[model samples]
Target: MMMHRQYLIDQAIIARNILRVALPLQRLRASATRPTLPETPTRFAIIAGDVTDPSSSLGDLAMFSALMQSLRAQNPDSIFTIIGERRHTIVVPGIGETPVEPAWAGKTGTLAFDELIRQHHALFVMGADILDGKYGAALVQRIVAYCNHSVLLGIPATMLGFSFNRNPRAPAVHALSRLHPHVTVNIRDQPSLDRFTRIVGVLAQLCADSAFLMPSATDPITEPEAWIASMRQEGRTPVGINLNAHALAPAIAEVGMDQLIDHFAEQFKRAGEQNGLAFMLLPHDLKSQSGDVSMLQALDQALQRKGFTHVRYASIDQPDKIKRLIGLLDLAITGRMHLVIASLGSGTPTLSITYQDKFEGLYQHFELSLEHTITPMQCLTDELLRKINDAFMHRHDNRARILSHLPRVKALASQNLAIATCGHTD
Candidate 1:
């Protein structure tokens, strides 16, 4: 049934794309004839919003950096700019910094929103938190209204399959769509594109998650043998676990911190005991003050009560370091979408404790059975345990299946980039 629905969705998108192309040619041609502005070399701006938070994983940053490299290689004249929060001093390699405008101050600085839009040829908006509430839609609309030649690469929360409510600021998005037709909006998943199109009356092109296209290493981490030896010496299995305790204001109504911590801790205990794996609590977003310290403390206490002595916790601040930790994992189970993507992309077997639709899309894209991945909020304990055990038993096969799908996802990303830049396949 899921396959059939996906097929129908794909067909609908293709049909919409055809209509969008055929219908817009005349309008585009008329706009094109007005004046051929002299082609200045293209400059790409990655408007990351916040880049220094502990919650921002290294894998995600690496993938975005890789995208910048690809763009620079394709167009050597292109320069890349990163507009980030004032406190975030951490930088992605190959990206130049531009300070982000404070929300309350309302756009005044050396790099004013209007001036930034006028200077850059393309824009890539990469973070998940940026799209919460109507901010994402409003931001895109603002860019479209002021910058005629720019594209907004949005990673909408709806990509994870959560519904996007029409907030009070939605009218701003609609207004911009009506006022500036040249601004292209691209989303990470199909459902988000569908929702955005339904609301704004402009078809949004679908693109695969950029994380999947990240370059894999033949040997990404150093001294793997030493790490493995240390684990063996300690009589531990070195299992990696990523628990997302942080919730943006928007996510609280859907799931709370206490429930999330309890759910993960319980699952970790069960999986560790059954599989002989020691728990390594991996915190993906350390900057959000989600009470990770308390959560870890709680898990440690739970492990002691259960008579499990092999447990450790690690927090990472750099993307390369995160990649190394992921490489060290014999197996990983995660709630964060990017963690699962990183593990799978790195050839590590993973079980996704799903909280959204993006997880389902990723599993489906890899042709993995949905039965193996659990939605903790919805599943019973018995069901969750059964799935975990099944994942362990079939980890090898599932890892192979996921690796096979990476090329297709990468190809899709490349194809989308071509279409977005040139309006046709390269």
Candidate 2:
């Protein structure tokens, strides 16, 4: 009987060891044939935000693209189990199999969390726009989930480069302090880094947004869209313009959003009449309910109503494709964060339409001149015309400046990914 009990204990310990190393094979759903691995395979979990959403911001796409590139490069042949909804699939270059269909998908939201603990080696909590503090409670909940699954369940959890910027901030910080002790927090901007360092003992390592790390995709839209063809036929230089939906929301704005839109239309109409400055009114995102397409259509109609026939709308969703499209432009004036990244990354002279501190941080990273960044509130004035014309006038020099800083920004972006995936213990 004692010998039998000893054998049972031995069995329990063996089971525990395996659970610590590999998630039970039965949990992971089978997919198309996978690449061969050694006797043992290492698996990492990437838990980012709702990147699959068609209307999702290009910034989110940019972040995910950079992350996957660096992670896959650093850990080739390692199994990647993406933790999120499995609705839409993003085709990352060189990935043979779908990174979805993980062991945890149906189990956590649909299946069970206890089932996931059985598979926990480590998890990367890659949030989307967490620093905006709009998702403070959501991020806190994620932190709690990570702590429960990792610390309590004996798995390592790491928080990648995210932001922490919220006003009336002190009361909101208690929850942030509750983040898993083992989790490494990598801040994306100097403001976030400074705030955390001063407020919390844990001064986060400052890193650039992952978007800067992404490579320009070779495949562009070969042909399509009547407006594009029409614009090309005009034989004038095509400049790209992107406006965010939220920035133009009537209810949200203190000023008359409609009037502002009209004013913008008039200014562009004036520019077009003066210099044949035609516009490719490109929408950066289409995922949100009031996404870029809605905003673009609204602005397009307003411009058309005012007799600005030179403005043509083009909606490109994929970041790579968008980058390629933006490259075709002589100049790009955009409010979309990733659009700006796309333009600058492609060595295209771009004007950044700033919405908040995020744009400031981004332009600062490349030491871009402040004159190039303008707020929507300021977009109604002569200042807008000056900035727009300046971009077109000094387009060549600006492109050179962007290219000069591209190497450094790329290095910082790569470093952000490195620290994020390194699983820092301290």
Tens-digit per-residue lDDT, 293-329, candidate 2? 7667777998899887877787666677777778778
lDDT of 1: 0.52
- Those runs of model 1 whose alpha carbons end farther than 4 Å from true positions after fitting are 1-42, 49-63, 75-78, 85-89, 93-111, 127-181, 216-225, 232-237, 246-263, 291-294, 328-330, 379-382, 419-426
Cα error of candidate 1 at position 75, Å: 4.5
Model 2 scores what on Cα lDDT?
Answer: 0.61
Report the lDDT of model 1 for residue 404: 86
Q: Each model's TM-score?
A: 0.70, 0.76
- Identify the runs in model 2 with alpha carbons over 4 angstroms from their true place: 1-42, 51-55, 85-114, 117-122, 144-156, 166-172, 180-182, 224-235, 249-252, 255-257, 419-426
RMSD of 2: 10.8
lDDT of 1 by residue, 72-119 (tens): 667877675555434344455455442343211123322243345445
